[model samples]
Target: MSIEVGSKLQGKVTGITNFGAFVELQGGSTGLVHISEVADNYVKDINEHLTVGEEVTVKVINVGKDGKIGLSIKKAKDNPNPKSGRHKSNPKNNRNGGGDRTESFEAKMNRFLKDSEDRLASLKKQTESKRGGRGAKKG
Candidate 1:
């Protein structure tokens, strides 16, 4: 079978590592399903999701010129679980309005100026104190 990007195929998990799982595709070719592509949720451990010799459906996500194949098990599923750790609530409806509000150019410039002035003043104060309050030290 010709393996092309976006093609879905069944493969046997030949090896498992911390980074990813290696699978032998239908045509005796091997592909790697990255740990992040193992599941829709965060996969801290690949072993928890795949085992050696197990069969799994994987979508060909990439095929490098070097003959390395990149697969995604999550994308092969009919209905992948929604991404975890993402709140379902809309941020725009939140009190901060989802941080969509933009600062006007003038406002941003003013804030920057104020911050720069404050930093400069603090630096000047530190330098003055270090030099014995600005006046030359008495011998």
Candidate 2:
């Protein structure tokens, strides 16, 4: 069977790499599901989600002129509110499968200010230590 763009097919995960996973689709065609297309959250590691020999349903995102195929497992239909324009929430963002409001702007601003001050102080100390607790001595 010829694989076309936007087609959904079941495939076996033949290989898993840091960048993406290789899936063997129907008709012996192999496609890559990029790390970013594996999920909506930060996929620092792809192994955490899939492994070799796993069967997955993937949508064909692209069919290159050179016969390369691109697959995606994180399409809209796979998650809730696919048309909401919001990314599928990561587990850390939800509690018990329920929506949870994140920190407000004021709270975020306060935290940013505190963190910035700490970083600035640390830099100043580093500079002072290198200069014997004063400005850099002139040559």
Question: Quick one: best TM-score, which candidate?
Answer: 1
- What would the per-residue lDDT of candidate 2 be over residues 1-139, giving only the tens digit for each residue? 8887888899999999889999998899899999988876668899999999999999999999999999998872456445443554477855335642576889767877998999999999988897788655677
TM-scores for the candidates: 0.65, 0.59
Residue ranges of candidate 1 with Cα displaced over 4 Å: 80-139
State candidate 1's TM-score. Answer: 0.65
The C-alpha stretches of model 2 lying farther than 4 A from their native spots are 80-139
Candidate models: Cα lDDT each: 0.88, 0.84
Give the RMSD in angstroms, all C-alphas superposed, for model 1.
Answer: 4.9
lDDT string for model 1 (41-129, tens) is 78898998899999999999999999999999999998766655354666565543454348688976786799899999999999988
* Candidate 2 lowest-lDDT run of ten: 76-85
Question: Lowest lDDT 10-mer window, candidate 1?
Answer: 92-101
